[model samples]
Target: MRMKKVSFLLIALVVAAVGFFIGCSPAKEPEKMETVRVAEVTRSIFYAPQYVAIEKGFFEEEGITVDLKTTWGGDKTMTNLLSNSADIALVGSETSIYVEAQGAKDRVINFAQLTQTDGTFLVARKKPEFFAWEQLKGSTFLGQRKGGMPQMAGEFTLKKHGIDPHKDLNLIQNIDFANLPSAFASGSGDYVQLFEPQASLFEKEGMGHIVASFGKESGKLPYTTFMTKESYIKNNNETLERFTKAIYKGQLFVDTHSAEEIAKIIAPYFDDTPEELIATVVDRYKSQNSFATNPLLDKEEWENLQAVMKSAGELPQTVDYSILVNTDLATKAMK
Candidate 1:
């Protein structure tokens, strides 16, 4: 009977050990908290892949619940990021560089580059004399905002052709994108750097002719970036990777998809724009090769963008690009 008791206790101990092992098995990684916040500036057709990622549940598949916020411009989005209101932002390299120089925040790191191709075009009323940059002297140039992409493009284009933006011609700021074509129609702006769809619209309406394309002239400068605060980077590394992975997927989608498919995805944002115009805009992005890259911009390209901004006086001083770029997570995400 004592022998039987010993064997029973040993079996009981073994059962308890097995139970404990089953109970304490690492908790299955806790389902990976599905929540994130991101922001993008402007409502344009080029952002179709981002919309596709969200619409197609790419973020959801990666266990992320995205809260996307849209703002007026990259400057405003930078403000939101510095204030810690948003986690990630789709912004231009020039705008972010200016923000870093201003010392708004210690570390607003830009990881991935988007939009290798600059899609800026100068539109003006068709005249025999207006075909070249030299003829633009003494004309009223309407610009979107001070230090924005349009301004930088205009400055670079003017400087390249030996025309003084400040002396030879007058540049008016605060010209809204929607109103630019109409203003051109009324002869309010002699020449304006308008983006796609708006640029296409002016051409279609016969109000303006494209004087020059800066993308063609400037080679290729890194136009936009996916950025975040330094604090976010340190604490939420996994979230950043997931976001980057989704973005890479979005870029590939943009590369392979049709114009009609792109228009369908971005149609919700541009309600007022006609279907034909939307198609044109999507085709333009495809034809011009304007989308964010996988693992984004490299160090040299980033510096080149800063140089362009510096020449345009967008940045007050030469600031280090390291403070505004973090590619660690993006590199990991690519794999």
Candidate 2:
């Protein structure tokens, strides 16, 4: 009876010890997720890689939860960034230059470029059997807002083709960016510049015909990029590195995947637009190599962007590429 009692006591003690140890052990904590607020100039198929990153779990994988907002125009997007309403701004590199020219206390920096070429397309009311640059002369041209990247690039291309936008065409610049398509549809101009899938949608609706691409004519530029204030980079270096990594992954996915696959993945973002139309726009951008395959913004592209701005008389003085751009995060991300 004593032996039986002793064995039971031993077993009970062992069980109790085990239970105590199990209960005293520390519990694992959940991973911390950082929220990054992004203000995009506008939402379009032009920013496909960014959409790919968000939809493919790349940003989530890097512990980032994106809070994206469309600010409609560069001015509004920069306003959001400067006011701390957005931590990041996806806009033209020229905005940064303009800010720097104005002597901002905390200068904006272009860390990762998203587009290598312009995104606008020239849509004509009537499809020309043989389209030429000279055809724009004496016609009412509905251009983008003055001093914006699209308008600057359009002017640059027009000069290249020997048709001065101001002298040869009746240029209209007062229309709001969002209303350009509607104005064109309501019989506003002989030609209009637009970003996809609006251009594609217009063609589908028989509202206009795509005659030429500003993206192709303007050559390679650091047209669209992801930028943030310099102070943000200094404070959130690690977060910025992770953000660039996700951007790089997004770029790779777009490069490797077909337009159909990309369109399918990013379809949710454009819920109102048809999948077929998305694919068509994606294919068009892909074919023209509009999307940057990587995040690094090189010096040559920077110089070209400046040239376009200078030609448009929008640039007061050229800002050095090194002062406004930092590729360190992009380099670390790629590795």
Candidate 3:
């Protein structure tokens, strides 16, 4: 019995010594995060994939730290990209196309396409049981500045229905997007076109209701894309690749999940909005297929967007497609 007790003590001492060495040994180092500053063109449910990525910690998973800054409008957002204040500009691909057409020294090259569907909704001041685009013929519609995507889209849709956006409807220009909903609610404009949550928010408050969905009308336009200077793209290949992979994962997460699930994930990132309204807004976007499944901004969509821009007189000249888009990075990201 003594011999057995001595053997047991010896085993215990060996185990204790092993454990002590393990405890004193160095731990595995945490990942050092890479930073990527993104200048978001506009804050809306349209860019839900990006918001989902940020909220779900996908950036951290990829060892990337994303600093998302909202620049309110695409013009300002593109400027941020031009000045090197932002590594990527999240705006319509047309903005970059225009820059290239204008002969910018460092042209914006689109790498990733975030959304494929137009996110604007034309909300009539009064809700109508039967909706039609022709109903807007004589109405004074609130619109943005000429080159803005929402205004251009609104013009495109109206013209498609045989109504002259410039002559058939009185379009009020240069209205701040923030004031559009309230301005119409206060009987300032007969109709107002705006991005999600605002349209639903207006509907929720009984101020205005949707008359037309631009996404459904526009049918797969290149709505939102991520671009950077050609020099930046050539230099920071690894950082951009990792960032794309993380956000592309977020895009897939959104595509597979229900609107309600994504709404909960992205609610905190948007303006202080209630979950139900967020869900409603998300459902509206989901129904229209607003997001792209991958980061690829294909040639067909790019051409379609340029056509729309040219139709609206926003582009001075057509740029060579290869010069404006570099999909190789996006391809690497997915792999």
What C-alpha lDDT do the candidate models reach, one value each?
Answer: 0.76, 0.96, 0.85
TM-score of each: 0.84, 0.93, 0.91
Tens-digit lDDT track for model 1 on 205-305?
Answer: 78787777776666566677778877788888888888888877877887888888777777777889987789887887677667664756677777767
Candidate 1 lDDT at 146 equals 76
Cα lDDT of candidate 1 equals: 0.76
Local accuracy of candidate 3 as per-residue lDDT tens digits, 19-133: 9999999998997998899999877777889999988998888899998899988889988888889999999878887787777988788898899978888888887889877
How good is model 2 by TM-score?
A: 0.93
Give the TM-score (vs. native) of candidate 1.
Answer: 0.84
How many clashes show up per model? 4, 0, 0
Candidate 3 lDDT (Cα, 0 to 1): 0.85
| Candidate 2 lDDT (Cα, 0 to 1) | 0.96
Model 2, 133: alpha-carbon shift in Å? 0.8
Which of 2 and 3 is the better model by TM-score? Answer: 2
lDDT tens digits, residue span 25-110, model 2: 99888799999999999988889999999999999999999999999999999999999999999999999999998989999999
Candidate 3 lDDT at 314 equals 79
Off by over 4 Å in 3: 1-23
